[model samples]
Target: MTARVPHPPIEPPGTRVRFPDPVLAPSHGVLAMGCDFTPGTLLRAYRSGIFPWPHGDEEDEGGSPLVLWFSPEPRCIFPLEQEPHWSRSLRRTLRIHPYEVTVDQDFAGVMHMCGETRKDATWIIPELERGYRELHRLGWAHSVEVWDTSTGERELVGGIYGVAVGGAFAGESMFHTRTDTSKIAFATLVTKLRAAGYVLFDVQVENPHLASLGCVEIPRREYLGRLDDALEVTPGPLL
Candidate 1:
C-alpha cells in the first residue's frame, strides 16, 4: 500500500475568513454556524448576505446556545414600491392612533423591546443586544420608534430596528405593545426609506406576519445579485 496522505480538518462552518456562498450553505438558509456577535463581525456578515441569529441550546452540545449565521435560500425583501396591506380596521386605527413616529430616537430601547422574551423564550440573547447597540453607535444600526401620546405622556409602544448599508436596509427585528402600533410604525418606515431613495429593504426571511406586510422571497442567487446593485447606490444617511 502507498503511504497515506493526511487531509486537513474542516474549519467550523462560517468560521472561515468569508461567509459560505448560497450553493455551499444549508437549505434552511443557514450559511454557517458558530460565531461571536461582535459589531464588526455583524457588519461583515450583513454585507456578505448573512446575519447572526441565536440557536437553541439543543443545537449545542450541552453548553451555552450557539450563534448561527444565515443566508436563506429564499431571501425575503420588501419592494421599493411595495405598500403594506392596510386592513379597513388598520386604516381606521392609523387615522385615530394617537402616536408619534420618530427615527433613531432610542435604538437600544427598540432592540431591548424586541429582545423581550415571553415565557422566557427568545432568540435575541444578551450578546446580540450588545452587538447591535454597538452597531448603532457606529451609525450602521437604526430604529424607527412609535410613541403613544394619547395620555399626555410619551410612552414607547412600537418600533423597528435594522442595519442599513448603501441602499439596502436589512430589518433585524420589531416590537409592539399595542394593536397596529408596530404596523403603523413599519408603514412610516417605508415612507421614509422610499423618500431617502432606498433601493432594497431586506427582511432576511419570510413569515406570515411579513407576507401580510408585502415581504416576498426570491432565490438567494437573485437576492445576491440585487444586493450588489443596492450596495452600488450612492451611500446616504439612514438615521
Candidate 2:
C-alpha cells in the first residue's frame, strides 16, 4: 500500500489554481499538489519557498499522478560560510584529475546525466526536465559541469544544476561518474556563489552525503526569514 504523504498541500475551494503560501505551509512540508509543472508555475513556486516533486506511482483517483509540492519544515541549506570540508581522499582526487569546470556549457546534458546516473529511482521526470530546460533558456536556471577530455572526446564526468533567484540557489540534483567529480562541481558552485554575494544555497533536504558537505537544516519559518535576506542580492556571473 502506498502511504499517503501526511498534511499534503490543501487545494483551495472553487479554484483551479494553487498557490503555496510560505507563511501557511504545513509542518509536514508539502505546500500544494496537482499543479502542472510548467516554467511559470515552477518559478512562482520557487519564489514562494515551495518546490514540486511528484509521487512515484500513479494512484491519484483522477488518473493523474499528484505533482506534490513541498517546503520542508526544516529546510536544508548550506550557508556560504560553512564551506564543504574536503576529505583527504577527495582532495587527492581533485588534485590528480585535470577536471575542467565550466558553467552553463550544457545544462541539458547535466540534467540528463543527473537523471540517468542515479542508482535508485528518481523523480527528475521528463516533465520536470522540459520545464527546467525552458527555465535555462530564460536564464533562471544554470549548471556547473566537470569535464574530462583526456580520452579525446568531450565527456562530462560530473555536474550539478539548480535554479537561481536573486541570491538564492535552489539545488536540484547532482551526479558523478568519476570519483569526486560531483564534489568538485558542487564546491566550485558554492565558491562562485559566495564570491558573487549569494547567501542561500538551498539543498531542499538533508542526507548523509550532504551532511559531509556541511549542509544543515533550519526551521521553515527561519528559512523564510533568511530567504527574504537572500532575495535582496542578485545572483549573477553564475560560475
Candidate 3:
C-alpha cells in the first residue's frame, strides 16, 4: 500500500512576513533576518530564491533567536540529468550493498538521526527542525531513508531531507551511521529526482565531499536565473 500523509490546517497569518531582495544582499548573502518559520513565509522565501540559515544565538524582538536568511554567491548545484562520478569501490558497493532504500517513510526519524549523528556544529536547531516538520506535513518537504535490515530489525543507517519547490529541490542535510551509506542515499536521490523531471538540485554550498560527487558551483545570478526557469516548469510529482 502507498503511504498517505495526513493534512492539517495551518494558519496563514505568519506567512505574510516580507523578506528583502536577495539580489541586493551583501556579498556574504545575508539578505535579511528575523522572521518566524511559518510555512507561507518559507514558501515565499524559497520562491524568491532565499532560505533561512540561522546562526549563533542572536535574538529577535520577540526574544526568540533571530532567523537569518541567505542567498549565497557561487551557489553549489548538481545537474539533475547528469550522473555524478563514482569511485570503483562505490560502484561495486552500489551493485552489492545490502541495504533498503525508502522515501518519506519516516521523515522525522531521518531528521532526528541527521541531528543526533552530528550533534557538534549541526544547524538543525529546535525551531528549524519544527519548521521543516511542519513543511513535511504540508507536503513541501521530503526525506530519503537508507535502512540496514540485516538484524531483521530495520535500522535507519543513513538519510537525506530537503524542500521541493516546483522543479527545484534544495538539499538541506544528510547523515550516515555506516560508511558510504550517505553517498548511497545521495546517489539514489539524484536518480529519483532525474526520473521525476526535476531540473535543479541546489546543494547551497560547496564542500570537498560534494565535489567528489560532481557538485559544481555557479554564480548567484546564474543560480537565480535557473531558479526562475525551474519554478516556471510544472513540477513532476516527487514522493
Best-performing candidate as measured by TM-score: 3
List, residue by residue over 1-239, the lDDT tens digit for candidate 3.
12444322233345657887788887678888774687888888888888888764667888877778989888899987666677888889888999999888888888889889976435567888888888888777888999999999999999998888878989988899999999988888888888878899999889998998889999989999999999876555554
Off by over 4 Å in 3: 1-14, 56-58
Q: Which residues of candidate 1, in runs, are more than 4 Å off?
A: 1-17, 56-64, 82-85, 117-121
Candidate 2 lDDT over residue span 51-89, tens digit each: 888666543568776578888888999978665577787
Better of 1 and 2 by lDDT: 2
Cα RMSDs, all models:
11.1, 8.2, 2.8
Clashes of 3: 0
Candidate whose lDDT is highest = 3
Model 1: what TM-score?
A: 0.85
State the displacement of the C-alpha of residue 155, model 3, in Å, after optimal TM-score superposition.
0.6
Residue-level lDDT for 10 in candidate 3: 34
Candidate 1 accuracy as lDDT? 0.75
Encode model 1's per-residue lDDT on 1-239: one tens digit a residue: 11111111111223335666755786687776664776656767877788887854445654656877888888999888656566787778878777898888888788888767233337778777887776776667778889988899888899898987667889988889988778887878787788878888999989898888878888988888888888787544543
When summed lDDT is taken over every stretch of 10 residues in candidate 3, the lowest stretch is 1-10
Clashing pairs in 2: none
TM-score sort, best first: 3, 2, 1
TM values, all candidates: 0.85, 0.86, 0.91
Q: How does candidate 2 fare on TM-score?
A: 0.86
